[model samples]
Target: MSKVIVLTGAGGVLCSTLAKALAKEGHKIAVLDLRKDAADAVANDINKEGGKAIGVAANVLKKDSLEEAKNEINNTLGTVDILVNGAGGNHPLGTTSNPHFLKEDLLNKDEGFKTFFDLDSEGIEFVFNLNFIGTLLPTQVFAKDMVGKKGCSILNISSMNAFTPLTKIPAYSGAKAAVSNFTQWLAVHFSKEGIRVNALAPGFFLTDQNRTLLTNNDGKLTARGTTIINQTPMGRFGEPEDLIGTTLWLCSEGASFVTGVVVPIDGGFSAFSGV
Candidate 1:
């Protein structure tokens, strides 16, 4: 059965792939992004491929924007059956240059050396709100349509750091952890309401948001990227397509009883203890 799905952050690499894949499965998709052109591009590609989709520009942080988007999606594609909260990112301000704290680093004047103490409050808050609050607001808006409605579910984007904190990205780690927690909370809260909530805890896939950070312009993996690859038992980063199967299953009746679980899509990165 076809359903209407709303995917926030659909303009980017991962969610865009998800949007197209879901559209191919005969679902009407709302490709939403902060940038109008980004949203339009994804929606256009889906439509050109004979899928039902519409591009909508809105900020995930704003409830008014989300409400407006809900109205538009409702009018154009019927009530939403699935909502994917994929609009979240990290900020430079929330990251530390060094993976571990060094006392000498605080005295160093190096431009790239940022200690945890140097982290900006604004940057930390920005990343935290983007991941956590962004997920909250969209659910607050679109899940309304799913109340008492079967075949309706919500998928949130989380990170592997949610399970274990990675180096340098404290803010993103904390935020995603919150997302995972909220997923469980929401699933239990909505258990009888016919609205299922879950999250995807992606380990590491190269996205535009982290491309430059993960790899140099020459396409060589940076130190952090190299560490991630080495740590990942699969020996390779995940592709966007890797997420489609899990996503489709969760949104389908196959996962009717599955809710509040954070499925890690990272090539066994989360399973290995790196002994």
Candidate 2:
């Protein structure tokens, strides 16, 4: 059975992979991204593989842009049968140098900005709005078409930081925590509507967004990235393909009873206690 799927941030590495997988399964995909060229490229590749898709450019932070994307999806792919909220990320300014703030750092302008005391209010608000409100806004715009539709599901992209805050990225951690919360909230809220809401919490995937921080230009893991890998039971960073199984299962009839859940695609990173 062919279904219509709408994926936000389709230009992104993970979402791009998911869009291709969903398209391969015979779904008509609406590939949405803030970057038009990236989205267009993904959609073109899918089409070349003999799948149906339309690339859409939409800023998740803007209501009108999302509305326009929704319109394009509706007119092009017959409304969304599956919604994947993949539009989110962290900002450097919203991060801190350490887990806790120190008094001396407050007096030093350079040091202050690097410490927890340096986290800018505007940057924090931006991260919150980007992940939480970004997901909420899209759901509000697209879920209307999914009401009473059988096998319709919503997939959100959460992070390992959501389960536990990582050092330096307080804003992103908290924002994704809200995303996890909203996933459960919406699942219950829309239970009667026959729509399932769930989230995929990826452990650590090497993507362009985090390339500099996670790996050197030569492609070896950085010190911090190496620490992450060592902590994972699998002792490896996740690849984009690691998420496809969970994504496809959730979108298929196999996951009809599953909702309000955060499925971690991490290789036991969330399960370990560093013992």
Candidate 3:
């Protein structure tokens, strides 16, 4: 059966792939993104491929923006049956250059290094708001349409950092941790209302957000990327397509009883400890 799906950050590398996959499966997709052009491009592609989709400009951090988008989606595609929260990322200001802190390093700070102490409150707040609060506001706005409605589901994008903090991006780690926690909270809160809430904890995929950190300008893996690959038992980074099967199953009737689970789609990165 076809359903109306509102996907935030649909223009992004990962979510765009997911949107196209869902569209191919006959879902009416509302591709919402802060970047209007990107969103429109994805929606147009879906439409050209014989799928129904509409691009909507929306900011997950703002209630008004989300409300406006929701109105447009409802008017154009009918009430949303699935909401995918995929709008979250990290900022350089919230990252540290060194993985571990040293006391002498704090006294003799390198101009190129961004220590934890050097992290800006504004940057931390931005990451937190984008990941945690962003998910909260969209659910608050769209879950209203799902209440008392059968087969309604929500999918949040989390990260492996939510389980074990990675190096450098502390703010993103903390924020995604909150996201995982909130996913469970939402599942339990909405269980009686027939709404299923879950999250996908992706390990590492090369996306625009972390391209610089993972690859150099010449398109070779950096030290961190190499480390991730070596640590992953599968010895590879995941492709966006790698997530489609899990995503489809979760959103489809196959996962009717699955809720509040954070499924990791990393290439076994979460399992190996580099022993």
Candidate 4:
């Protein structure tokens, strides 16, 4: 059952692994990213491994860029049967230096120490637009191809923070929460269209996106990273490969009856209560 699948942010760690995994499973992959070289590299690897894939450079935030990508995808790989919205990330401006608000921090601010009051609108907006709008625009452009088509689905990348907001990154948490809500709304909206919509909420994976915050330059886990491992029942950071099984199942016929569900791929992170 080889189907055309478009993965936005395929240049990223998680999605790149997913693109390769899906392609290895015989799906035609459109490895799309803002970086042309990153997308091309992933696609090239897939093609070299005898998988069908094409690299396409596209901006998730720009409708015109996405439209252009859709055209290329349609012409080259055929209509998209599956779309994985993987284009969202957090920005430093959207984060606070400390998890809890402190008066001294605001009163005597140190260099590079940003508090809640220091959260810039521009940074917050960037996070929101990247996670929420990024997901919406791609669906608006690509889901049309899945309309009335059998065995079509859209998988959004969410975060465990969506269920329970983690410390510091407010904008990323809120945007991901919106993504979870949108997943439910989309599934209902497209229920009669033969298109399924769902989302995956990953807990803690050490990708380049969060590498600085999670791990120190010396290759040791930071305080925050250590805290995450302690919190996660699995006691370790998730590998990119950890998401593959659930991702494949959600995209497969086994999940035909499942839609509008935000599946937590975290290893007991969502279920645990730190006692």
Kindly list the per-residue Cα lDDT of model 3 for residues 85-167, writing each as its tens digit. 99999988899878999887778656767788889899999999999999999999998999778889999999999999998
CA deviation > 4 Å runs, candidate 3: 109-112
lDDT of 3 at 213: 84
Candidate 3 lDDT: 0.93
- Cα lDDT tens digits for candidate 2, 12-58: 89999999999999999999999999999999999999999999999
Give residue 55's lDDT in candidate 3 (0 to 100): 98
TM-score of 1: 0.98
Per-candidate clashes, comma-separated: 0, 0, 0, 0
RMSD of each: 0.9, 1.5, 1.0, 0.8
- Ranked candidates, highest lDDT first: 4, 1, 3, 2
> RMSD of candidate 3 to the true fold?
1.0
lDDT of 1 at 114: 86
Query: In candidate 4, which residue pairs clash?
Result: none
Which candidate number would show the highest lDDT if scored against the true structure? 4
Better of 2 and 3 by lDDT: 3
Candidate 1's clash total is 0
Off by over 4 Å in 2: 100-104, 107-113
* Model 4 spans > 4 angstroms off: none
Q: What tens-digit string does per-residue lDDT give for candidate 4 at 183-253?
A: 99999999999799999999899888899988999989999998998999988888999999989999999
What TM-score fits each model? 0.98, 0.96, 0.98, 0.98
The TM-score measured for candidate 3 stands at 0.98
